[model samples]
Target chain A: GESVGLHLPTLSVQEGDNSIINCAYSNSASDYFIWYKQESGKGPQFIIDIRSNMDKRQGQRVTVLLNKTVKHLSLQIAATQPGDSAVYFCAERGAGAQKLVFGQGTRLTINP
Target chain B: NAGVTQTPKFRILKIGQSMTLQCAQDMNHNYMYWYRQDPGMGLKLIYYSVGAGITDKGEVPNGYNVSRSTTEDFPLRLELAAPSQTSVYFCASSRGQPISYEQYFGPGTRLTVT
Candidate 1:
């Protein structure tokens, strides 16, 4: 995932609402993508991931959708709660390479 | 397991001072990575190692050096500190390579260069 500068820095969502955060990547060579969540002053934690061949993948309460045609990636948090509040980042990895390219990051604030 | 751990949560360095950031992983991961995160910016890869004794540079590797002498340790070196080098540094490791595997990260080390 890529950010020209800093576009979506913050996102506010109600406790029970489903939140959608968007990300765009510049490198088309990226074949695998993943989402990460980082709490204040903490390290980024893996959320979900999807391969280029597939368009969508889901996990516990999160879903990741990849649009290779548009070079877009998005993460959907179902029933966002205060516990889910954190900075969400999208990452991309090239085929057969372990290094990942990270997105700027969007701070997801779950309002109670 | 402590997953991944980094030493010196914070540090302040002078323009020409040099220091090393230490990273250790307990999962015995074959792949390890070092990244720097600037305020309001994405994490930029500095260097990575697939296994012990192998190392390579990533997107923004300028002025940064790394050594992976052990399977569990990856250290980042800065010879001459610069204001531009101030940022939060992270170390991560994973059992999978190239394709995919959940990467576990350390708390991070915040650095300040005056």
Candidate 2:
């Protein structure tokens, strides 16, 4: 059975600070990992992704770190802002798999 | 380009009723998928199509059916709505294998069965 899980269900961060959301995946064969941001009543939007071959990948203001050794994944938001307030989800795809296994999202709240 | 569009933004159906959730994508993507999102839960794949005239069952395909007549359209059908079928349905598309390509999701259709 393949499973993706988040470390925290909710995270509150002050504006301008940094936020780190952790995820754990069970499948060792999974090579592709993605982080998505879902706003209220909207579909999940792609944020960033890291392949198992890469340890780190960065986007505009977000970074995705993949630790294949521990089967852990994480998304870091630098200078978090109010607009970053949304539910974040981590998804993983095993080799030759057609679908992604999503983790229960973590609600990110940006506090003033 | 309307990347992906799903009709009937919201719908309320009675038990035993039937309906189709229409999905269309203009990206010319070869792979399309149907997923359901329960409250406080993650998305579960119900069905997927690799290309036109080709469809396959996903992790949660029960109580639903799908058709891919064209590369741009994939519709999900519920033979008989049930209370457990009440959830947000999303349609997604990707150019190729998900292992390398990212999926683009639609706004989603909120279906409630009473």
Candidate 3:
């Protein structure tokens, strides 16, 4: 009965501002967590990932923070742009698991 | 590299129809996976394969079957399509074992079952 879920179903942010998308996972055994971005009419693309051992990981203009104690994960995008509009999903995989469990996803819209 | 590729970008099928969803990867990855994305929802695992000739059922594998004959191909077959089977199907691949979590996804095939 493992489940990964997001805090919000939809989020709107100013184009030049920062955006944060949160996720809460139920499986404490999950050791790996990933953030994926899905643009319209396309498959989900890998954004960033963090392991339970690490608290945060950064890439380009994005950052992923993992709070294992609270079973929460977050993806932060700096200087959000129009191109950042998409559905963002968080997925988790337990140790030695062959597949990942994905959350329902958050629709992130960048406002001008 | 072409990465992961799936055939039939879009399809419409009648209930009880059968079809095969083709997936191929040129990256020479040992791990392949099939996932279905429902509207306003996330992706659900249908099946997965680790290397050629090795297949396993995933979280949602009730109406689907998969075969991994070669490292490059892993096809998912639908025996009797139903309305609930309509969704966007994505194929993904990654290096198996120690480095298996960072997956590369395909463009996806949208199927509508009426």
Candidate 4:
């Protein structure tokens, strides 16, 4: 089955440093991608999203970069804080599909 | 707005038991979804509803069922629960087309099957 996967299962970063998480997807028909953050005992929270037509999108403190040619995506967080530590996941939506497929996820740990 | 709300934050069900996980969103969104998260893994979609009375299966829809009777409620039903079914369940809703991809999630229901 075609699925989305992360480059690393866990990432350790120091406070105030920038962090990047990478994901690879096999579905070329996907036209939309999204990033989500999930904390302990909570559901996934929406972070940012990008369309296949555009290569990059930015939020307040987060940025999502999409590479359609390589079927890859990345989420970058600037000036990582303790609150930014959580499990991050990348999801993709196939064309005309109502459900989004999710990647394995990367646990981002911030050391203060 | 409460955004999305789910009942029974935690539960322990014995084998062969059955239960329905309730999910309701006050946003009145047109789309709803159900997903399960296992330990150290990402979410697997169980089922999804495009709108009231329209439902469809997702990546992993076995051992689960869902129905959308109203615009705000989408409940997931599990019959003859098994140990493998022990996981955290989440309900989410979105307002726009699939391209929008902005989903609001509920707190989640944690279930343990013995």
Which CAPRI quality tier does the interface of model 2 achieve?
A: high
What is the lDDT ranking, best to worst? 2, 3, 4, 1
Native contact fraction, candidates in order: 0.91, 0.76, 0.79, 0.91
The TM-score of candidate 3's chain A against the true chain A comes to: 0.98
lDDT by residue (tens digit), candidate 4, B1-114 = 999999989999999999999999998799999999999989988999989999999888999988999999999999999999999999999996833558999999999999
* lDDT string, candidate 3, B17-108, tens digits: 99999999999999999999988999999999988999999889999999999999999999899999999999999896686588899999
**Candidate 4 similarity to native, TM-score:** 0.97
Superposition error at B109 for model 2 (Å): 0.2
Candidate 2, A1-112: lDDT as tens digits: 8999999999999999999999999999998999999999999999998888999999999999999999999999999999999999999988888778899999999999
TM-score between candidate 3 and the true structure: 0.98
Candidate 1 positional error at A77, Å: 0.6
- List model 2 lDDT by residue over B1-114, tens digit each: 999999999999999999999999999999999999999998999999999999999989999999999999999999889999999999999987743568999999999999
Candidate 3 regions exceeding 4 Å error are none
lDDT of 4 at A65: 96
Residue-pair clashes per candidate, as listed?
Answer: 2, 0, 0, 0
The local lDDT score (0 to 100) that residue B37 gets in candidate 2 is 97
Ranking by DockQ: 4, 3, 2, 1
lDDT of 4: 0.93
Predictions in order: chain A TM-score: 0.91, 0.99, 0.98, 0.98
Question: What DockQ would you assign to candidate 1?
Answer: 0.83
